[model samples]
Target: MKHRKLISLAIVPILVATFIATTATLSLAGSSINPRLYGSDRYETSTAIANQFSNQTVSNVVLASGNDFPDALSASVLAHELSAPILLVDRNTQTSKAALDYIQAHLRPQGTVYITGGTSVIGSNFESLLSNQGHQIKRLGGSDLYDTNELIVNELNSTSDTVYIASGQNFPDALAISSFASQTNSPILLTQTNGLPKGAQEYLTNNEPKNIYIAGGTAVVSGSVENEIKSISPNSKITRFAGQTRFDTASLAYSQLAANPKTIYIASGLNYPDALSGTILAALNGDPILLIDPSTPLVPDSIAMYLAQLYKNGATPNVTALGGSVVVPDEVINNVVNLLNGQSQSPLFNITTVDSRLNFGGLPVNLLPNKTIGSTLTLTNTTIPIAVFIRR
Candidate 1:
């Protein structure tokens, strides 16, 4: 028989277990992986996003209606071309006042402020407010959203042979391709579901771009429109980025257009304000803006899987959410965190025991149950001399 001494190691197990639980909690709730950029309202949120561009020299500012999305959908490329920030404003004097203040403070002296819509969307009073500040104001509004889009493209003065065509009826498809458009200095023209907008038709016929990328499926932009595009620009190579849903379309666009983004900005696909302003930031960083459905708690399966694969491939890009909790809730971020942690398809809470080996004075000891000691002992490498057990 071997003589053995009973050592009381009750405290070690409790401490180690507590540390593991706390660490797991922190890892799940940590904001380091996904930071949010939002405000109390859409107007203020655009301002909050604009603040991110403060470090850079922003000589031009693109102003669009916060209440509407059409005119602003195609402004990202123009904003990127001018090295400016896209700020959304409302007709409400109070809301527009804040944007004006931001412009006055941030805009370089004699900086040009480009307004996207006509007086109907963004009233002339707001234009007057911007002009009163001594900043040169250029209003790009046309007869309709399509014309406005064409005017914006013309302002780009881009000689690039690539052009993107997305639906004018909806906001998602255009925004899906906005960042890529900004990157290539390509113009994004809007067309009706069944026909091409006159302005877009004329522009395509005149410029005759070498490449035309159409966003969304036939449901939003029917085959008729594609045929019309072919008639107008026969030589242009047309590629369509469409999916069963808007989220899928956005994912497809990101995967095809942006090769390897250093950062990914996740925005609400149901709404347009956050993404409208965020596009400039994405373009400036040469990153991709991925749209997420806010109504669902979990991220779309396709996006979650793609992100998990990106992580597994050793690409750890910084992820940022674009709106407040109401727009993009914590549950969505939690799901994103799981994907980034390489646990997208795994169980939610994975509770497992740590190693049972104990390091005591440079010696490995296994915890054995003895009649004298009623408790089991397990250990990890810690300052404590005794063994410990950690279940996380």
Candidate 2:
């Protein structure tokens, strides 16, 4: 009996180990590769993002104006909700050649393709062209940007306590936060800097979203407009996230809105094409997109600081540069890579006048905020984790 019990115990351990190995394999199968989806231009870039899900079967797809901003800003929520990708189509060309080819190759024989905006923005024949290709078409748009925004919001099956608001005149703020908005199912509404857009006002009047997050500072969205928002929903709380520049604002958004993003997409702040497509890809991967200028000599200060802080906290995030060399450039990529590899540039000068400080009797520095200075202070570890390197 003792011999049999010993044999059973050995067999049980082997069985448990085999089960764990099998479970791990199954879990890993669901997680896929993180690819930098891009193309020659905006049209192709959007196609590349859609191709990421090509292997899987989807019943629907969403189309938005490639040349404009307002329609696409409000389309992300519906796109995410429907498990659809937002493809950019030229208003005059109807659909770009690259997009049509991608659809024919990757997303054919699907149930429907919902196109946003009316015929004026997308051309009247665009719908018919898709219909002729055997793709069932549904168009969503209104007479103006405000009306279209309202129309888009109404399509949502439900709403959350939070909503995101950005200027309709531009695309940066909206693109930067699209992934977070989609993930949280928060509706993004467009507003003028000085006042609220009609669609935004209408949506607030109809549905109550208690928490509203405003992207960009007063320059992009003015104080008067903020007051109007307060008047609309007096009880609702408002939060603003902005920085010295658009790139800073994007980094701030990623830092505050996302929780330890495992991956981040770096795109040009000067252009819209790369980021427009990149946003959808980032959202799909459950990541955030940080903006940077490819033309700059070094990574912008705010972005570098944010990345340094992230690295200091023990995060090894996957960094992807969107667009080709022309859009993001090699120097920018090198700077970001060096940061991730912990090969940051050395400081300009450290303790230049150490003897001078000794001769003058160095004073105890109180770096701690809001602390009253005292005669004696304890000094812990003296090493600073981060140092700023300045170029002369």
lDDT top scorer: 1
Each model's total of backbone clashes? 2, 0
| C-alpha positional error of residue 338 in candidate 2 after TM-score superposition, expressed in Å | 2.4
How much is the lDDT of residue 124 in candidate 1? Answer: 83
lDDT of 2: 0.67
TM-score, predicted candidate 2 vs. hidden true structure: 0.75
| Candidate 2: worst-modelled 10 consecutive residues by lDDT | 18-27
Q: What are the TM-scores, per candidate, against the unseen true structure?
A: 0.78, 0.75
What lDDT is reached at residue 106 by model 2? 53
lDDT against the true structure, per candidate, is 0.75, 0.67
